[model samples]
Target: MFDKIFQLGLRDILDSMPSEYVSLKEAVEGKLEISLNNGLKHRFDAEEVRKLSSIVPLYLWSMVRIPFIMVKLSSPGEYSINGSEWDRRAISLILNDLGSVISVGQMELLLREFKSLIFITLGYDSISGIDNDKEGI
Candidate 1:
């Protein structure tokens, strides 16, 4: 009863959250439990949940070319002699050397999906009583 009303009010708040957030409006209002990765579950209006949350894609753009990274599109781009087949070999050699020195790594493997991260920020849920402020109060 009370939860339903609270969920209605939180519609705007939930939507304001960043992408990959799972809304609990469904469980509060409609008794639906939507499960996500990392043991993070959300039960909210399935319709609203889809609209409120998004999957934030992780991009691996790690590169060592600091100076060349910002180069614009084709205002006289530099190539190591396009006509020479050796150019490919040379480039591959450079990349291999860089790979040897550079470290490859991942972070927060448990939080695979972005939604799980958002849930972590929000914390987990428990049973609500007449007064949510005090436990068994």
Candidate 2:
């Protein structure tokens, strides 16, 4: 898994994204939009994303051991995200690029979404942690 993330590098995926500098007010209000050269569009919800930023880096590092432990401790879901040194560098670069446009306060959301995007793009099921079959009692 690590080798895979390394091979797919964030730079190669995000490439050159053309972004606009938005005010902190706009960011916190969830009014920021980023359009990549590949036609991918990201419209951020500040409250939601900001809530996720601070812990994302740590999550990324630990995700390799167990991805969704926080979601369900009993099951803890899958054990994947085996990253490499290059992947670390790629994450740094990606965060740096994100930081340039996103305000410090809003970075958590961005990082959280970014992590999900990467995981989903790499063929991981976005809903893997949800136990749809569980009975509601």
Candidate 3:
């Protein structure tokens, strides 16, 4: 059930996103770069972002002890989840590649972008609304 919904949401998001935001090569390589307002940059590889995407969501859900929750859309293609909202240690666990120099705001922005890319590359069901098992008309 979770997988089904996840796929559906992913497809919907991917279809609506712009062409530049949906890159198979970047998704596969897991290469991400974030530029902060402070004129600094942080680089993340595919493995790092993948780990963050899986870990951060689970951690948040674990705290609430819920199996699933409503994922609100804060923007056109971005979910409401902010990774920077997590504790400093938790954020460090994901952005360790850049050491402990990143701020909460920067991490949050990066996370939002990360989520966008993840949805593009991860599970996608093009036939989300179409039922394949239906009998012939």
- Total backbone clashes of candidate 1, pairs 3 or more residues apart or in separate chains: 4
What digit string (tens of lDDT, one per residue) describes model 1 on residues 5-117?
A: 86765554444333332223322244445434334454443443232222211121111110110101121221111212232222233334311111111112212322222
Clashing pairs in 3: 30-46
**Candidate 1 vs candidate 2: which has greater TM-score?**
2
lDDT of each: 0.26, 0.36, 0.37
Off by over 4 Å in 1: 20-121, 126-137
Q: Find the candidate with the highest TM-score and give its number.
A: 2
Task: Predict model 2's lDDT versus the native.
Answer: 0.36
lDDT, candidate 3, 5-28, per-residue tens: 977876665454333221223433
Error of 1 at 99 (Å): 32
Q: Per-residue lDDT tens digits of candidate 2, residues 50-133? A: 433343454343222111111111123312222343333333444454211223333354346553223222222322444333
Clashes of each: 4, 5, 1
Worst 10 residues of 1 by lDDT: 64-73
